[model samples]
Target chain A: MSYIAWIISIGNELLIGKTVNTNAAWLARKLTLLGYDVRRIITVPDNEEDEVEVFRDAIKRGVRVVISTGGLGPTFDDKTSEYLAKALNRKYVINDEALKLVIETFKLKGLELTEPRLKQAKMPEGAKPLPNPVGTAPGIWVEEDNTIIIALPGVPAEMMGIFENYVEPKLREIGPKLHFIERSITVKGVPEADLAPIIEKGMKMSNRVYIKSHPKGHEIRSPLVEIHVYVSSEDVRKAEDEINKVLDFLIFAVKEKGGEVLST
Target chain B: MSYIAWIISIGNELLIGKTVNTNAAWLARKLTLLGYDVRRIITVPDNEEDEVEVFRDAIKRGVRVVISTGGLGPTFDDKTSEYLAKALNRKYVINDEALKLVIETFKLKGLELTEPRLKQAKMPEGAKPLPNPVGTAPGIWVEEDNTIIIALPGVPAEMMGIFENYVEPKLREIGPKLHFIERSITVKGVPEADLAPIIEKGMKMSNRVYIKSHPKGHEIRSPLVEIHVYVSSEDVRKAEDEINKVLDFLIFAVKEKGGEVLST
Candidate 1:
């Protein structure tokens, strides 16, 4: 079974240019490394309706796992948890474990837990609270109809803390069996078309080999074309062998065309 | 009227972690700087069904401008233009201007225009072709029922070129009359709870003031709390005065409580 995951990055700071969203990219990289196919990464503002719509859209697309970052704080704009609960058609309740974590966090910081801070404890009914070792807001992990929905705080440190502590382990348990290997060969002094025939020949030899070309540098200058060879398989050894064969052929082909392979 | 924009980043590389999605972040920063409220940024794999669903979803959310990047190439995976046409129920045809641009681009590179390469010319009927001066793929600009949809090539350089050349001008002409201003003050030598009352008092005096506390550093040391104040309004002068009043009070209160305001 092929596992597909969707990412929803929720915040107005991202949309308003007040802050940069490194969360989606970081998560995409992590998920890909973990053998889960990140099908989509969506950024929605703090608006409840838009957040809810994105969640529904991911579900409709048959995403088995949905990881949402941001808007799980005590502030009024942090509406991700509420919208998520509403989308799942579940009532919002303060999970005891989340409440305990919040209280402990406040006590450690020597701060009184205010009403707004208490709001962080509220989660969707039947949701499992993922402990946030770094912050007061606990990440919520909910399972519905075999789909896993994880809600983590937008703060980078807290998000990472929760993911490492709870989400990562759960992901490994349920994730699909997959392996991917990639090799990129940078060719200089050769147009992409000149290398196309070689790439076509290589791809024809192996069904697992796929090639993509990217032009590098300014339009006026001699563009460097980097060809990426991707090989994916359930067996790691087979995937690596497929990638190695394509790389070997690509290097030879570039030299045959009187072009140098700058790097691989 | 407040304007809301939606960003749709399309690619399969994003899902598999082959590529980090820098497009969404860059687009968000640009839209925010242009004073447009970007409501959502969604990343989806290069799937026709997902593309169509996302387009419809963005329209239903009443977003005035929808900017989608990627899948405007000649490959089989590049189905965004066709799906966009099917979703809008518009006819699909080879836009003459776009075809000319593609042919001219290939000719400049001295590359033979293959059948797949020529496929870049086809676009949704009635859509305006936005010039991609740097690349072969041209962006498509479609306006339907007051909502504008822009389809740009996935290549980073090509997307930026088309957006800067065509889309930005059109967006500036029809955007909303709204502005956002933000200021942050770092408070040292005090816990957040003690600072909350002072901030609350300041907020009660000024309706436009918003205070957010961010804790920094690891668990072993005392975390630094930085408070951010955001003031948004159509009238710049009024908003500035409101922000200044709160800023002055916050500084005074922090000083009285034996805490220093690092900066404003």
Candidate 2:
């Protein structure tokens, strides 16, 4: 069975549309490739109440994994650590390892540790800090009865750094064994409305495979559509076979309907 | 008071990272510009149960406006309309106007209306169908007791066509009078940790103005950061004045700390 996951992206910049939320998309891609069924991608503001509420809600929903990005900074609005502790009913304390990492990072710059810099070391009691190789604020990892929550910095580079180095390996060990396979084929001269029945028949043929169409041309005139066929299953060979069978059937059906298969 | 808004982006392709949710970002930007305080952006798969659950939850949360994109198509998995009717406890029916639009679209394509294509006209009992300028599926608009829900097609061109032509004008008429102003300035040579106190002070001086710092450079070395200052108020002049005041103070503070003002 695929493990359920939710991605919480925290920042006022995202809610206000100042940022495009590429972090959520990137995480979703990684999680999906790791065989985790990402159920939700929630973007909330930097407010403590909102952050804590989402964290609690994720736990209540019993998702196996929860990954959040943003609010792991030294600014007054960066409250992910504090609010996560409140949500988990844990004491907010200074973690020794996180503090040492922060001190070492600042020491490299030939500077003394200030209060704002030290704030990066604070996390929920019993939570572990994943060392950040490129930034001061380390990624946070918290394990609960039913959920594992990981909070990373909003910075693209820092978030990617910790996720690739620390989180990916651990998740790979525990993630589901499902293998996913997908293929896309572009068709011309066939409107999506006309191709809908063919897609429906294709889906009915294989209950395991999902077929979706994206129209690239005008509906009333020249119709160009890209059909995506994908499936995930415990058996890699079965998954591949299912995808190939459905793909061949779709190509044959499209050509039978006078549609030109442009590319696969 | 700023009206609260939420954007629900629907599609499995987005969840699996096959597509980036640019539709949500575009809608959020438009809503924010129209003086709507966008609170959340939720992305869910193309499942009827999940769609209905999120729609009901948005109503329970009492957001003033909820806009959803995707799943309005001529395929089997396109269930946004059906699930929305269920969520609102309204009988799903095909309206004459919507039927006419769908028939005309098919006629333009020199084709007869099939069952799957006809399914696009079905909507809640009291809903209105926004005319689609570029696509076959008409956008669905439903007004609840305290919430307004608008469902548009998942296709980027079609969704944008309906929203820009039909929905934006009506929203402008009923939206809040607040005007939002934002300004960003880049600074170098001052770490974000050191700039945190100044940002906190700037925020304290003006409760209405929000100031956020985005670190562009590494913390230990050449520290480069961009500071965003923004505010929204009923009075356009007051909003502009407040933003300028906060921006000036932040710039002065950054320069006072020996940070080079790269650009504004």
Candidate 3:
């Protein structure tokens, strides 16, 4: 079975360019490192209809895991939790554990608890509250069948804190057992076309080998081209060995073409 | 009608976490600043199937403009141009203008032209080749109805170079008459809940006003809360004036709560 994940970033700030949606990129990188195939990422303004549509579409597309960031705060525009509840057709209530955390956080900060602040405690029925030691708003983990949806705060620091402290470990526990590895060798001074035959030969030698080139600087001026080699396999150690062998051959090929490896 | 755009980052490096997809963020910022709603961002490995699936999905979801980055290289993995052609049901052919540019680039680089390098000149039939003065791979611009799909190189410098020189001007010309402007004010000392009432009043004062809270550094024992106020309007001056009014009210409310505005 193929495992896929979808990321949703919820914020009007991101949509309007007031804030960069770093959460999606960060999560995508983490998921990739953990061997989850991130199929797509969606960013929507704080709108119930748009968020619901994205959520429903992702579910229908057979995404095994759905990670949502942002709009979990204690304001009117922060409507992700409630909207998610509505979309999932689940009842929402003030979770005691979550409320306790919120109240304790307020007391620790020497702040008065307000009604909207209390709303942070409310969550969709059956959803597990992920501890948020970094913020008053707790991350939520909702599971239906085998598909999992984790809702995290939009703040980069808070999101990272929650993911590192709880989400990452939990995901690893439930994630697949497949092992994947990638390697890159930067090449300079060689035109990409002349390098293709060599890359083709390298790929033929290693089943997992792939090459990509990126041209740097202005096209009119002198451009620097860097070629990256990627290798992935079920056995990480074997993948590394295969990649090293290919890299050695590629370096020789570059020199033959009057170019040199930028660096290994 | 609200304008919506989608960004597709096509590369294997992005999938393996070897490279950060900065192009998506940069393009998102640009599109947002231009008053275009970026609905989603999809990053797929340099696989034809995944590329076609993502492209079809984005188009089905009604994205007016789909900007694809990467996979315009002169290698076997550089199949974005071909896959995109299949997705759009168009024939792939080498355009004379693009061929000339590719040959000129190789001539200037003092590199012998090879078959794979010549493939960089091929584009979907009837597609307009966007100038790529910085690299051998030229960008392709294809339009069907009101939806526009632009394919550009993946390299950050080349992507930005082509965007600034070719894409941006064309986008502005075909884009909506809407204008976008935003301002953020950071607030500290008040919990988001206690600040909700003030935020509600601020929102009522202006239809475009929206407030979001981001919790920062919660794990360090003392957490800081940053609230951002965003306003979007078709008229720049009106938007700025309205945001200022909301800022004034927010400042008054924060001061009433014995809190302070960190920045305006």
Error of 3 at A263 (Å): 2.7
Better of 2 and 3 by lDDT: 2
User: Which tens-of-lDDT digit does each residue in A147-178 have in candidate 1?
Assistant: 78999988788898999889888787777656
Give the winner by DockQ: 2
For every model in order, the TM-score on chain A comes to 0.92, 0.96, 0.91
* Top TM-score prediction, candidate number: 2
Q: Rank the candidates by TM-score, best first.
A: 2, 3, 1
Model 3: residues with Cα > 4 Å off, grouped in runs: A216-227, A231-234, B216-227
lDDT (Cα, tens digit) per residue for candidate 3, span A1-20: 65798888888666555565
The i-RMS of candidate 3 is 3.1
Model 1 RMSD in Å is 3.4
Model 2 C-alpha lDDT per residue in residues A140-232, reported as the tens digit of each score = 999988899999999999999999999999998999876778899999998888899899999988888999998888876788999999887
TM-score of 1: 0.87
Q: How does candidate 1 score on lDDT?
A: 0.78
Error of 2 at B245 (Å): 1.2
Q: Compare candidates 1 and 3 on lDDT and give the better one.
A: 1
